[model samples]
Target: MADTGDNSKTELVQELNGLLADHFALYTKAKNFHWHITGPRFRDLHLLFDEQAIEIRDQIDVIGERVRKNNMTTLTSIGSVAKHTQVKDQDSATLAPDDMVKELRDDNANMVARLKGMKELAEKAGDNATDGLLDDWTDMAEERVWFLSSFLK
Candidate 1:
């Protein structure tokens, strides 16, 4: 509501934190699927999951840079990610191919939703740079969701 400088900066920092947390969770879930998937679809699903995980890992760098540009510290540790992230972790040895696909699809969808919400926040803060970063991630997540969901159907 107010056009105060501190409030705008704080809002941007909070939004960045939330986005970082969600992406961290998505990245972990993708890696989990990559490690655990097995069955008739093993090769396809495994490769797909690995690619998606790497994409998320790349996004982490982009996100961290944006946070630093905003004059805030990036939450870069595993402990911070585990504490702040909303997506649940999986036991890498336990999931079947179908289960892995389903879990990753869900995580991608969730990440897309979170990024969209963050985009709105970034726009409100007049932070087009962060909004553009989220736009790229949202598209990537949606594409991954489609690819992962195809394994189930």
Candidate 2:
């Protein structure tokens, strides 16, 4: 691929791909927790998790499209996701409600960090469109972290 005058284009795309992978992992884990959570707050947590998962899924699609806009193919398959994702995977087993909330809080915090990093990369690469997108994504992830943290308290 020819350089678009900015040498950071490739690196920026790679970072965006990582963000996409993290969102994928987080979305699956949120769905897992949604399915397995039980206890006093079952209904509330279940609904929250499902909503968060859908939002994360939508973010993943936006990110993949961004990659395409940057002229790179999006990552595909679980293997590719695993390679790029920095979010930790959870066992496919039931978890206590508090534990599920805690895990998601930490993961969302991590996602916020990743989004910030991507935002910086996009700025450095002069990719204003991606930088703008990251602003919305980072705000959403930060809200998830806050809500999950509050729930655990």
Best by lDDT: 2
TM-score of each candidate structure, all chains considered together: 0.89, 0.94
lDDT of 1 by residue, 10-92 (tens): 77777677678877888777777787776877888789988988888888778888878877787868888777787887767
Count of steric clashes across candidates, in order? 0, 0
lDDT of 1: 0.79
TM-score for candidate 2, residues paired by index: 0.94
Model 2 agreement with the true structure over 1-153: per-residue lDDT tens digits = 345686688899998888889999999999999998888899999999999999999888899999999888879899999999988999857778888899999999988888887777787778889999989999999999988998967
Give me the candidate number with maximum TM-score: 2
List per-prediction Cα lDDT, in the order shown: 0.79, 0.89
Clashing pairs in 1: none
Q: lDDT score, residue 148, model 2? A: 91
lDDT of 2 at 31: 94
